[model samples]
Target: MPRLEEITPDNVSAAVDIKVGPEQEAFVAPVVTSLAEAYASRRTAWPRLVYDDDRAVAFVMGNFDPDNETEAFRCGIWRLNVDRAEQGKGYGRFAVLAFCEEARRRGHRRVTVLWEQGEGGPEAFYLRLGFRPTGEVLFGETVGELLL
Candidate 1:
């Protein structure tokens, strides 16, 4: 199994090179840049880069936020990606599971994942990991949630 590590400037370039397919390129390009910024920010967001041995293979970026005026923390899982050459080897699933576990460890009660509308891969993958669609779409992205 590949081990997950925190994203850093040293590995950010390699992580940004991971791609799913030609169709996903346009979708993931901007996301990669945004994730890099989040990683460099002061917020509590956790952006991770996964690796097998010393090679970068996947990534997951997310953060914990307080809901409304309550003390409850709602976790938001942002971007998740596994290299096309490394897909179907369980890397993506492992990354998501690890991210969720980390979110729980951070005291979040729920973790939400947002997927692009046309990305069947993400929808199916998240579903397989126990996330259910919330019937809510935000800015062309579908929202799914898994209670921790």
Candidate 2:
């Protein structure tokens, strides 16, 4: 069974080791980079690792800042990286569902995600998860939202 774990000294290194395939790399940032961003935005960043027993399988980060000037950034999936070896094993969807639950718990009515469109991008996967494009684009990434 896979479970989401809060990043800690004991598991921080394991989280950092998570990686996506080379083709998917252009779609998202790595766990280490996401961790750095989380540190910089500790007040709003929520980073977690998905572990199947003792094995780390994926990393997910959400940014929750209700007062942010940008509506999309107020609550959204900031980064998600599933290990190259763990792709298609449901870890990515699990991480995303976990993030959505967290958003609802945080009093958010919806959570948004920005995905770049390309042959190997996550646009299709996110859409399949029920995130509808809001017709907004930020920094060249299509803005998508899922009502909670």
Could you tell me the lDDT of residue 137 within candidate 2? 91
Runs of candidate 2 exceeding 4 Å displacement: none
TM-score of 2: 0.97
What is the Cα root-mean-square deviation between model 1 and the actual structure?
2.8
Q: Summarize candidate 1's per-residue lDDT along 61-123 as a digit string, tens digits.
A: 776665534222257776777788888889888888888888888787688887775644467
lDDT (tens digit, per residue) of candidate 2 on 2-52: 999999999999988887888888999888988999999899999999999
Candidate 1, superposed: residue stretches over 4 Å from native: 26-31, 39-41, 67-73
TM-score of each: 0.84, 0.97
